[model samples]
Target: TPTAVASTIKAKNYIKTITYDNSQEDFVEKWLDQVFSEALQIRSDNKFTDEVPQRYEVPIIGFDCLKSATTLIFMNLKSNKYEIIDRPGPRSCPIHIIVKSTENSIHLKFIDAKNYVSADMELDDFLRDIGKVEPCESLIKESWLLLSAIDNRIKDYTDYHIDLLQNASLAKLSCLKKYAYCYKNFNISSCYNPEDKANPFDLSMRYWKSKVNSYNEQDKRKKRRIDHNITYDDYQHFHDVFLTQRCHMCQARFTYNNKPTLDRIVNEKSHTKINVLPCCPYCNNLPMTISNQEVYDSLRNDMRNIKISDCAIRKPYLRIASQLNQKRRDVNAQHHYKWLTLQQIIQNMDYIHVTDDDTDSLCLAIAH
Candidate 1:
């Protein structure tokens, strides 16, 4: 790895040197032309500074040119910097980096993570910061959870911190187990099995196609162009997310009640890789008229009443499901009250006339 990085740096330096040489020659020629035109003599100091700037050979670590497509962990020896790139999406590669400024301090800024944690902060402070970020707070959490799994001290902070730590750890354990293939020889085709009906990739493809057909039919009826331009590779990435077994929207484990549904994060967007995420059916069914921010805001509001738990359904998810259950109960209660009121009104009435046209509607109301 060092040799490869050295060769790469050497090639880059050589090209830079050639360009610098050409530019310097041009400048010297121009200077000489001016000097001769004015009859001037060149002068220079005999002494040259002996001090030489230190140079560090770049040491590329834990990075494979091909295998590191998903994640890249490497160090720049010259800058003494560490970087972690997570480009899990299919259509684009968003960069994530960790910069070290002092021996005891590091600054982390990750777009996918959506938050930064300073190494100098106390454990409590870090937890406090993590609590502020809602929904898919950290890709770095996977690494931190793995560390906590190995070393218990990292998670032995406080009750609240431990709850958050365990939530993330369990998410990592439940979701990341699917990535068992050898990265160096990983074949995307291996994820799919034509004969296996239970295969997630196949299931996702079927679901994606059904949705595409459904949407296209609706759009055609409305005289709008079919906008679902999602590719097979994009759907495959959605399946990879499904293999995580957690809802990307609410971080809930996939269960019978809460099956995985591939959905657009923003309803206005097409089913592209970056726009799509694996969420539960309930979240998938959220009103399309709502803006992405409004949808998340509603979920966040529902999440406020829930506390972090060790269950497969975490706080943010359970709250929404519970809210649905509560709404169903409320509807039932309202129907029962209306039915009783109708019965009382009928009992108080004298002979009433019933027409054939109103009979079916009346029976349906009575049944409810």
Candidate 2:
């Protein structure tokens, strides 16, 4: 035989399991290579000696590794069993790796054997400790994004509720879904319900009202002085002329001491005679007026000049004016006959000629 070449392959006694604490990187690699080479040598006697077949293209399981860690796991590719290589690392090591196996899968976990302190734990560290498992990072990031969106949506709904409460408008309650969808990812089970007795938004609204009432009370307290010199005659006259009377301009009755200011009085230019009509606050502020005769003359002239095309515009005006005239006639009849109802005097007679637009403008004036 030729000079015998000592094979890089080691003998059967070559250590199948190696453990090292505080081992240099090169030494660890060399040790692993030798173990693998020895394993290969042991199987060489079989017919498959020319081909070293791998059971899996990649390691079936992979996780973090630290020097001096004990308990390595080796897979017997052919047997589909894990060999728990105990006494795997040197003594006085900070970390250990443990391997446990169920029927079909190998589980690896890192154990911190020593009580040595490390840097503050980070997300990455936690991830590494758990091993590079699939889909974990992506799942965490998606969850966080959803949480942030929900938080912002809740804040928006809260602000919207406050605005609606302040304005005393219930119209937007119909759009609860539009507002709620902002928190769609959070699975919030309910939307804002102002009528719900236990709702925090409703409770907060009540609290706000109470605070406002307190502030109003304080303001009243600060302005408590009365002007005693103001004469009853003047007060009574003003009350009669403005407060107790109906606004001649828009025909709204006022019961409060504060009547609509002259600036807000609409249709004030429609009054005429100084003596024929009382100089109510509204009439006194008129820009122009038609005397009784002038009104009759105007009505008669307009009727005479009416054209077919003008009928469209004139018809509405005439209809409303006729209703107003009828109301006036009825009032005069009641006053003349001394048969006016107390209710009519107190609530003011219903004047159906008043258009909705006129009614709204009159209400605003009365509110002042």
Candidate 3:
């Protein structure tokens, strides 16, 4: 009965993405026309299905941006609940749009409902700054809605990290649990020795403290009060106790030469527990200026032919990323701090090569 109820609920909540070609002139007008056509189709489809559970909901819209300006419209369901009307005349709901702008054109990227409202505000600010707000008044009003309607379940940083740890691998999960247990009574300071080079955790903590101090110094120079209130215990609880076996950015397993280090996800932010994550030394050495989106784009471009469910980096992609990272540094050195663009990285892919011969050696070089 539970399975049957789930099936019925799924059937009633199922909604498809309606796409349109925005390449032609008067694309906005054509998009509106196609939206109307989809509504008509929904009404017609409902006529054949007498079951309310089988009725269609409002479909999302995706625009082809390869040849034209990309504008993707997604459904903003209130409280993550799809409105399944018993007596619906073509189901309708609010829409969320993403507009990614380049030098000459704009494209759309897939974003969830939570980001929809922020995207709207960003779009509004952009339009207003460029003095084009009046022209897009109707467009903005139709698509944008107050984010207060959506329920935000993320209460604090602990909740966020707890969710992140839920997505950890089994190996990582086991290590985390074990480390957390061991660290409860473990005296980290007792493990530190001035003469011991083998003590990585101690050395890593020293380095982390130095970096945090440097960040605070920079804030002092900027006349901002040093807000980096992170303690050694916080580091122990969040970072050192995690027993990270893989790089959070590239998912590369840690080796003897590639040990874990805390990398700041956002450099401008403090080295608080929430801002840092375990990253391999190799990945940590990569260009610090690279945005999270740029890294994803680079990886996606390199692994276009590979089948990956969550964009997890393979050995070959990892090598490619390393090469691109080197390229970024070289360009920065030659061009005076200019970050390499995604297109440049993609263009250099033909020159980048990786081999699987070191698999045995890599597996052997696993960190303790």
Candidate 2 — worst ten consecutive residues by lDDT sum? 359-368
Displacement of residue 149 (Cα, Å) in model 1 is: 56
Put down candidate 1 lDDT per residue, 1-368, tens digits, no spaces.
21111111112222110111123433323322332222211111211233222111111111112233222223213223333332333334333223222332223222221112332544334334443322234434423332233233223333222222122233332222222121224332222111222434334577767765665565467565455455454666655666665655445555544567666655555544566667766545533332344433333332212332323111112112121332323333235223323322121111111112222223111000
Model 3 lDDT tens row, 63-174: 1111121221222212221122222121232223333222212222222332222333443343343223332444223232211111121122132122211211223333
Flag clash pairs in model 2.
271-289
Question: By TM-score, who's the top model here?
Answer: 3
List residue ranges in candidate 2 displaced over 4 A. 1-139, 155-228, 241-368
RMSD of 3: 22.1
lDDT of 3: 0.34
Best-to-worst ranking by TM-score: 3, 1, 2
Q: Per model, how many backbone clashes are there?
A: 0, 1, 0
Q: Which runs in model 1 stand beyond 4 Å of their true positions?
A: 1-205, 218-228, 232-235, 255-257, 288-323, 326-368
Q: At residue 24, what lDDT does model 3 achieve?
A: 51
Least well predicted 10-residue stretch by lDDT in candidate 3: 1-10
Q: What is the Cα-based lDDT of residue 210 in candidate 1?
A: 74
RMSD of each: 27.6, 34.5, 22.1
Greater lDDT among 2 and 3 belongs to 3
Query: Across residues 1-368, which tens digit of lDDT does each residue of candidate 2 receive?
Result: 11111112223454223333223443333444443434444443322322322121111111122332332322212233333333334553433444333343333333331111133543354334322322243433423332233234335446433221111112333233233343234221222211212211111334334533543454346552223212223333433454344444344443322133222122322111121222223223322322344332333332211222322222221012111223333343223112211111111111112212322122100000
Q: Over the full model, what C-alpha lDDT does candidate 2 score relative to the true structure?
A: 0.29
